[model samples]
Target: MEPSPLGSVDKALLTLDALGRAGADGTSLAALSTEVGANKSTLHRTLAALRHRGYAEQSADGTYRLGPAVLGLASAFLAEENLPALLRPALDALSAEVDELVHLGVLAGQEVVYLEKVEPRRAVRVWSAVGRRRPAATTALGRALLAAGPLSAGPLSAGPDGGTPETEAALAAYTAPGTTTDRLRAAVDEARRTGVATETEENEPGIACAAVAVLRAGRPLAAVSITAPVERMTGPARDARISALRELLPTVLPAGLAVPPAP
Candidate 1:
């Protein structure tokens, strides 16, 4: 007989809770099974599915960790949860001013997962999502969040969307065609200094974007970004977009949601 699904597979999804507790270090099968209150065999299959599609990974030491793929799903879920819902109207207003696509994203491992998107009227607009994923080291939205994270946070790590690049090439290189890893590092530093980040055709040729991070209780919760066509992205105009995003930062982050967990 086919097995039943777990706990309606919604807000109470045990895997998310497990991953949250495990943090970046990941957890062993035995440990996660205990945390989720599920049998080892059942959790193994669930984890296998998560692993098969890149939502989870088994480290060399044999522990299971959240994979890059899960970021897309989690961001989508979180944005719809409560906080982002309140910010949607404001994000929509920003989209109106930009006359291009706008998106809200959050850093997940080495990338930003699109949490919300305000599409332009045109059929030729950049087609991504409220759930699509982009590399943190390569995309403006990701950089914005990374730059705004606590000073103790480390640089972006490797993820699955692109694959397992070697340490040298991944750290010292730029996966985006026209950029370098050093340049990305510099951009992150700049964003930290100025409170925002921007990109010109780095993610996609002829596409330009500006982003500002939303911080809550000293942690970066998300970033708001404006995307414009290359032709219209004048230098000062780009700066203006970044500036506008900064204005919304305080409103986007709530008073005490930063920790996402109780202390």
Candidate 2:
């Protein structure tokens, strides 16, 4: 048998649960007492304790309701979650449906760091690994993230002195020999207009990719990309691959995460 819960803790939790069910209007002290099956005096003490800890609030009309602390705790829990672990199932299903390599990445300064990857059964695969970082300007994943709002200088920041333009210049110095700042800026703009980003051999030779941002509260929390050989990703086939990502990715995303709507 499970150990019995402590009386004080149990009472507090039961009161909280009751308040939650009571909704935004809150509940009267008498009603809460009846629901918890405790005497008015004991229930009052419990309510007082809950209020002291910020777990419950009393309205001007003397009704009790859930408090801001509950939301704070929820936000803290979400912040501590591991992104790769939370989204693995979705990544796996997407790779299976598209039969191509899928990558999950986050922006780190001007680069995108790969957090998770799912590979298909084909012998030919994109050369990528977890923890590897790539230029945000040259890769589809980074461009998708950049396209979503809330960059340090704002999305596709065009200020001459800083933001995307400055980052583009810095990226150009060390990126693949042929990649140019103008081309990278254009890719980001395209992503903003089209709601997806694409790269052709910009990150690696013979590789092509398409990506979409995973958004939270209107900001890009991460990005997902489908990578394949250049031949398989060009012409009409490229359109099909991109369509697959837009169509299939949303189906497997967990609650609280979403892809931008098609433009």
In terms of lDDT, the best-performing candidate is 2
List model 1 lDDT by residue over 79-101, tens digit each: 53554685677677777765668
TM-score of each: 0.55, 0.70
Q: Rate the local accuracy (lDDT) of all candidates.
A: 0.68, 0.81
**lDDT per residue, candidate 2, 1-263, as tens digits?**
56446888888888999998999999999999999888889999999998998999999999999998988876764452478888899899988887889999998877789999998988655678999988787889988887784332435445656456556554354344445666766787788778889998776789889999998766788899999999999888788878877888888888767888887
What TM-score number comes out for model 1?
0.55
Cα distance off (Å), candidate 1, residue 21: 29
Pairs that clash in candidate 2: none
Question: Who wins the TM-score comparison?
Answer: 2
